[model samples]
Structure formats: structure tokens, C-alpha cells
Target: MADYTPNETGSQLFAEKMWLQGALITAVGYGAVLTLYVLAFYLLLSRLDRWNRQAHAIFLVYITVQFILATLFQASSARFTQLAFINNRDYPGGPGAYELAFFYIPVDMLGNIVYVLSNWFSDALLLWRCAVIYSTCRFPLWVIMGFPAVVMMGSVGSGIMYLLQVSTTSPFLPSSANFTIIDSSISLALNLMLTIMIVGRLVVYRFRLKTNFGLSVSQRDYTSVMAMLVESAGLYAAFSLFFIVPFALGSSVENIAFQALSQVQVIAPFLIIVRVSQGKAWSTSTALEITSASEGLGTLKDKVPMAQIQFACASGDDTSMPNAISHHPSVPNSDTTLTTEVV
Candidate 1:
């Protein structure tokens, strides 16, 4: 590698430095979010009033992928750091940090594909919950199958785009990180709207069913659904400013802002989703207030969660088998849950 004296000015160097700063920030933030998410997920799983084992398992997969992707994207930041340091100074190669920076295109591109697919999968998981939520309503079969089929297409398209870029002569698109923001952006918008639409339909159908049954949709039910939607909206918000400031202006500074914006993109959703579900918010709400009344908070004499209650009454049972079998109901702060078992 031959050294060539560079004529990059101070402003150019500062701009590069900021992108590196964003990368370092991403590395640190990704590690922190992954740690907190794991601890929080386990803590949530321990509590009683929550997503069923099936839904919880789906979430387990979703969050796990999210954590891995964030870590990879952060790892990709090292190249930016090198680029920043070598900007004004003479280094080897035409692009002093090409060896370092070159890998970023695929990293960003693959990460974005997985990122989008995971969103679709997450929403599909939500739809699965909807199938459960509206099972009683007998939500039209078409809607059930149709909504998810459409959503899956977006996830598929995202993957195809990634494969296209990977298999092409260009491993990384020279600009825009080889993951076209335009296609990605349109896909994201379509997804958010799709989720909102599907959820909106669920809400309507839910209320209609309740009305027919001479029962109003409970505040608790509404709260649970709203909480889920909030997660989606929060995710969309993460990418909101990125497109607005950077590509909207179509300037290099905007591109620089775009780079930092990418870090925030991963940071916000990872924190919001992982944190909210950590403590099993559904089961532990104060409004439920059931277990709180128990003297030991429902713990047995030995201070365990009393899996089964034994009752031996005066009923005539010749085999010495008890007349009653009672397992401690998994009521939480409240004596009631949505009763997913029944539905």
C-alpha cells in the first residue's frame, strides 16, 4: 500500500468523526440492550398473567433475533471508526479504510433485511394472537388467512432484495449502504399501515362480538391491545426522523445524520419492546389485585407457590383418593386474567 498525502479539510474530518461516534455509540447501546432484554424476558416469563406459552415462545424468537441483529450492526461500526481516523491523514489505498468500510454494505443490507422480516414475523405473531383473540368471534376465515399472507410477502420481498444485492456483482451498493432506503422505506410504511389496519379490524370485530354477547369490551382487554399497538407505533417512530431529515434534504449532512439516525433506529425499538414485556406487565398489573390479598402473596407454608392444594373431605372414597384436586390458580395481583385457556 502506497501512502498518498490527502487534501481533505477539517470540516470533512469532523463529519467523519461524528459517524464514527455514532458507531461506537451503537456498539455500546447494542450490548446494553441485549443484556437488559435477556434479564427482563426471563423475569417476565416468571409472572402469571401473560402471553400464553405459544405467544411467549414466538416473542422469545423475535427478541432473540433482534438482539443478534443489533449486535452485528454495531460490530459493523468498526469500519466507520477507521474511516474517521484516516480521513485527513495520509494512509494506504485510494480509500484508506476501504478494507474496513467495504464490509459495511452487506452488514447494513443483511441487517436491514432481517430487521424487516423480523418485523413482519413479529406482526404475524401478533396476528396469531389475534386469531386467538377473535376465535370466539369467528373472524372470517379469509381475513385470517389473507392478512398474514400479505404481510409475509413484505418479509419475503425484503429477503429477496438482500439476496439480489448479495448475488449481484456489487456486494455492497456504493451508496445508501447497498440496501436501498427507497424500497426499504416503502416496505416499512406498508408494514406499519398493514399492522395498524389488521389490528384495527381486530378491534372492531372484538367490540362487535362483545356487543352481540350483551357484554362490553373490558377496559383490560382494550389496554392489552393498545399496549401491543403502541409497540408497533414506537418502532415506526424510530425510523421516522431518519428519512425525514436525511433523505428528505438530499444533502451530505443529511447523509451524516442518516448514519447516526441508523443507530437510534435499532436503539429505540429494542429498548421499548424488550423493556415493556420484561416484567410480564399483563399478569402483574395492580388493577388485577388478586394475589396481593394472599398473606404470603400466595406462597405456601414452606414459602413456595403451592402447585397443588390437597383436600381430604368426609366423602366416601374407598381407594383413599381425595375427593378434590386443586392446583393453585395462576391469578396474579388480580384474581382474574383474560382466561386464554378457555378461549
Candidate 2:
């Protein structure tokens, strides 16, 4: 038998409304999202064609591992926390599978190990991609890419040390000091460096784009492509604030905080995923706009297919002949490479 109600202050750390309403709601929500992530990652692994195959593979693995951790963490947290809230709770009352799983917290540490390492691994992929994208002439093959890899090695090295030494009882609970601050500090530092590197890469990319393609997005198609980047950046920034800010501010280890941050961490990558999936520009609207306006120079139109332009050529509001020579902007190449820079 076990105590169901929120107990001593130390145990209150596990306390959350988990019985009838709140627990059920959380269980359903987390379960649904986790399922979708699993399916999506699998499908992506199957269908990734030209996208950075190396980075995509790393991303898929990362997502898969995160999915597993999320599944286990959700199940354990829900049951343990709900048991905390249930009346007349029981733990070791079961003799079969439940007991076996409940007995192996040390083994479950491997899941946590996967969780953190996968995070840094995915970040390393992004950091190097950005370095390549930022490089003006040829992508930086060794130095810039290797720099992030070294940092990743450091992060992983510290993480393994902390995981091996830490003494956690559950996925939600922090282990000893090595696991808590030592591992956490290293993670935060690496992630912070990653964030800065991403910003720098984007800056370098914009500069390159400006220097390469001119600072002005004169064409309508270019404007549409820029919109996608802007939107994704906003999504990225929002998710970053959710996790990065909390880590920087030293928030408490309450289960609610843990759950909230856990969810944000889980969903953050999907934002990036959607952005990558939506590659290339030249939308229908851009085409329509270009169609509505004459193509050619303002004063004298090009001798190609151009948009309609009416003129008051003293013959009333006479419609100018659909100039056979006037040119309307044509979407250059449909297969244009829309750069999906990782960060």
C-alpha cells in the first residue's frame, strides 16, 4: 500500500492533479503527440531524397530516441504522479512486468543518456550545416564544421560522466550534483553556444545573399521565400525562449516545470521540421501578381509575354494591344534550390 495524497514537502515534488480529470487529460495529450512524432520521424527517414542525408539521418535518430524517452517518461511520470494522487495506492503489489520495470531505475538511465546525447548530436548537425551555409565561396569542410563537432564531443563527454556518476531514482528526478549542475551546466553552455552560432550563421548567410543577389528582394518570388524564413525564425525563437530562458534563469525542479519544459523540448524540433519540408518558393500568388503587372521596364516593356497595361492614348481609355513582345516575369527554374540552412 502507498500514500496517495500529496505528502511531505519533499514528496510534494511529485504532486500533480492526476486522478480523474487532469491526469487523464495529460495522458491523452502527451500520448497523441508522441505517436505522431514517432510516425513522422519514421516516414521522414523513409522519404528523405535530396535533403542533407547525413543531417537527416542524425535528426531521425534524435527524434526517435526523444520519442522513446518521451514515451517512457510520460508513462512513468503519469503513473507515479497519479499514484501519488490516487486513494490507497499500491506499488509492489504487482508481481510480473510492472515490478520488473519499477525495479530498474538504474537501467532506465540509459534512456536519459540517449535523451541528452541525441539533443547535442542534433545540435551538432545544425551547427555544422550553418557553418557550411555561411561559408561564402566553398562550404567550410574542416575547421568550422569540426569546431562544432569538438564542442559536441565535449558536451557528450561531460554528459556521460554525469550520467555514470549520478544517482537518480526516476526519469523526472535529478540525480546527485554531477547529474544536476555539472551535466546541466555543460548542456546549457553548449546549447547557448549553439544558439549564438545559429544567429551568426544566419547573419553570415544574409550577408552572403545580399552580396551575391543584391540587398533588395525586388522580385515577388524572392519576397515569398524570405517570408518562409522569417516565419520559421519566429517559430524557432519562440521555442528557444521556452527552454533556453528557463535554463538560464535557474528554475526549480518541480514536476510541473519539468513536464512543461519537457513538452516544449519535444515539440520544438517539429517546427524546424515543417520549415524544411516546405522547401522552395514561387507560390501561386506570386505568379498571379506577376501576371497582373506588366513585365518589362517601367518606361518600355520587354518584347516578351507581359501583363496587360491600359493607356489613355487619346483614343479614349483605349486598351493597349496585348503586346506580343512584352515580357511578364516567368518563374525561372522550378527546381531552384531553396536553402534550408540548419541552425
The TM-score obtained by model 2 is: 0.54
Q: How well is each residue in 1-343 modelled by candidate 1, as lDDT tens digits?
A: 8855356655455444555555565566566666766765775466425545665565566667666665655555554445535653345333323422443356445544544444454445444544443444446756655755675575567556755655443332355554445444544555456456546654564465445332233433433465555434445444544544454444334433444444444444444445346532223232223222222322332333334433343343454654222233443422222221111
Range of the 10 consecutive residues with the lowest summed lDDT in candidate 2: 334-343
Worst 10 residues of 1 by lDDT: 334-343
Off by over 4 Å in 2: 1-65, 83-111, 135-141, 168-177, 203-254, 280-343
Residues 80-159 of candidate 2 have per-residue lDDT tens digits of 44433353243332212232234235433543554465455445544543443435435445665576567667777776
How high is the CA lDDT of each candidate model? 0.47, 0.45
| Number of colliding residue pairs in model 2 | 4
User: What is candidate 1's local distance difference test score?
Assistant: 0.47
Which residue pairs collide in model 1, if any?
A: 49-283, 288-333, 288-334, 289-333, 289-334, 290-333, 290-334, 290-335
